[model samples]
Target: MATLEIDLFTARSDNFGVLLHDPETGRTASIDAPEQAPILAALERRGWTLTDIFTTHHHQDHVEANMALKDRFGVTIVGPGSEADRIPGIDTSVGDGDSFDFAGHRVEVIETPGHTAGHICFYLPEDKLLFSADTLFALGCGRLFERPAEVMWPSLLKLRALPADTTVYFGHEYTLSNARFAVTIDPDNAALTARAQAIETLRAKGRPTAPTLLADEIATNPFLRADDPAIRAHLGMEAAEDWQVFAEIRARKDRF
Candidate 1:
């Protein structure tokens, strides 16, 4: 089967509105609905009818347009099973390790519950695409609003184990700021320093850095590198477990 065509645009604030279209079936799915107007405008631009919504979590900014879009396009909304009660207009509920179909491709649901208790991410193994709304960002992970560091660290491991080439589509545009913080934690990483310089250029040009390579994130993102010796040493936790190191990094970020 052909991979789904992707469309990404800025929505309310820094939120990224994404649309995935299957050319073979003429069916399109919105990764999340942050705003009604932008989504409608994007659909109009591509002349694609909205067929479904693959919700990542129950955050307001990520799902506020759910009912409106569903009402207008009669879209079927699929969301995390654990937080289905919180997702507006959720028609189908799925959880960790669940796989569903969109067009002829398999959409694997990975439950990442750090940002929220029932937060999830969508991964298409065939296409190596991961819609990691709020769970994993370009250079950072989401804040733990509903869970703690221990719970979130394992959730991150699930994503880390994915293919290195997986193209990650994050929900927000905080790469520039996250990069600024990253250098402080993993200062000696040459790859990270180079990536930060590039991000600085991208932000200066007003470009979006949503789709980052998982390999780059693994090499630089402090939250994902708690097990790395350099970061653990930076935090003065060389003997600590990975999750404990992650907690220290998160604590520092919360203050940063």
Candidate 2:
């Protein structure tokens, strides 16, 4: 099997559009279609025909160009089963724990329902890559729009359990702001301090800070550090349940 080739590009302000291709089979898939123009240009540039679309949720920005792209390419659309009726061009619906093959690669669907009630993430184990969408981000997690922090925390824990080296590809380019907020919550964390400085340099250059390593997130992301003694102590929730600690951190971020 040939290694998967991934192309990451900007679309619709801060949204990141991704294309995944299997070089051996010449099969390609777009992670989300925030808009049609850039995605089309990307495909044209690579000369890769889009065979499928893997949507993470029903958010308009995430699925706005679904129909246009599908019409243009006649591609297969796959998305969360819970939001099948809501997604614009869904053809195949999958839920948590479901496994499907994409050009000989096994993709696992993980139901992550915090950002939205039907949000899902795609994990390709062989490649150690996870398309987290809006559920998780670098140094931050999605706002609880449709679910409570308690519900969202468990969803994050599931992702945390993946191998430390798994590369996480999230939906937006919110790292710079997220890093700033992370420092406020984890003021004493030396690792976070250094990470924030690095993010500043990247943003200064107008570069992308996504596809972050899971290990770095676990080490520096406050949302993923609710179990860490230092973070729990800073929140004065050392004796509180992990969920309680998570809730406090999320509430603080909301106000930050």
Candidate 3:
């Protein structure tokens, strides 16, 4: 199996644009074309040509450069079928449980529709990599823009059920701010405290705190800790359903 090489770079403020390349087949894809300049630059730096684009949602920031890149490289644009009307230049539409082949690798689409009614995430089982997009962030999850917390909580749990070693790449650089809110809720978490310190150090040095491991997220990310007894206890929701606990956490983050 050929290893997937990922190049992650910042685009348009806090958004992250990622390029996934397969060395063996020389096929490359952009996870989301948040902007044309950075995505094009990353492709140029690696001497790779963009052949496909995997869009997670219909948000303008995530798809703003899709048409530009497609016109330049004639790339195939893949996005959620649920939001086909909203995604520009989308050639292929997929929903949860749909699987497809990309540059000799299989990609699984997981529908996560809290942030948007049609949001989806890509999971590459072969590489153990997940492109979580806006659904799940470092220490926090995306705000419930199109659906209620009840709907979004299950989507998060789905991502959390992936292999422990799965490398998670999310949409933005909100880890530092998320860490601040996380500590306020789960103050006694030693792992979270350590993770918070590390996030601060990385931010100070101008580093990206993404591509985090699912194991670490499960251990430290408060959004993913809804099932944790400690978190429930702290929230005084010991008897609450997992989704209820999750809703409270998300609500707190909204106001944080």
Instruction: Score each candidate by Cα lDDT.
Output: 0.93, 0.93, 0.93
Per-residue lDDT tens digits for candidate 1, residues 48-93, read: 9999999999989999999999999899999999999999999999
Tens-digit lDDT track for model 2 on 1-256?
A: 7789999999998999999999988889999889999998899999899999999999999999999988988999999999999999899999999999998899999998989998999999999999999999999999899988888999999999999999999999999989999998889999899999999999999999988999999999999989989889888898998888999999998898
Worst 10 residues of 1 by lDDT: 247-256
Residue 156 deviation, candidate 1, in Å? Answer: 0.4
CA deviation > 4 Å runs, candidate 2? none
Q: What TM value does model 1 have?
A: 0.99
The candidate, 1 or 2, that scores higher on TM-score is 1
* TM-scores of all predicted structures: 0.99, 0.98, 0.98
Judged by whole-model lDDT over C-alpha atoms, candidate 2 comes out at: 0.93
In candidate 1, list every pair of residues with a backbone clash. none
Q: List per-candidate RMSD values in Å.
A: 0.7, 0.9, 0.8
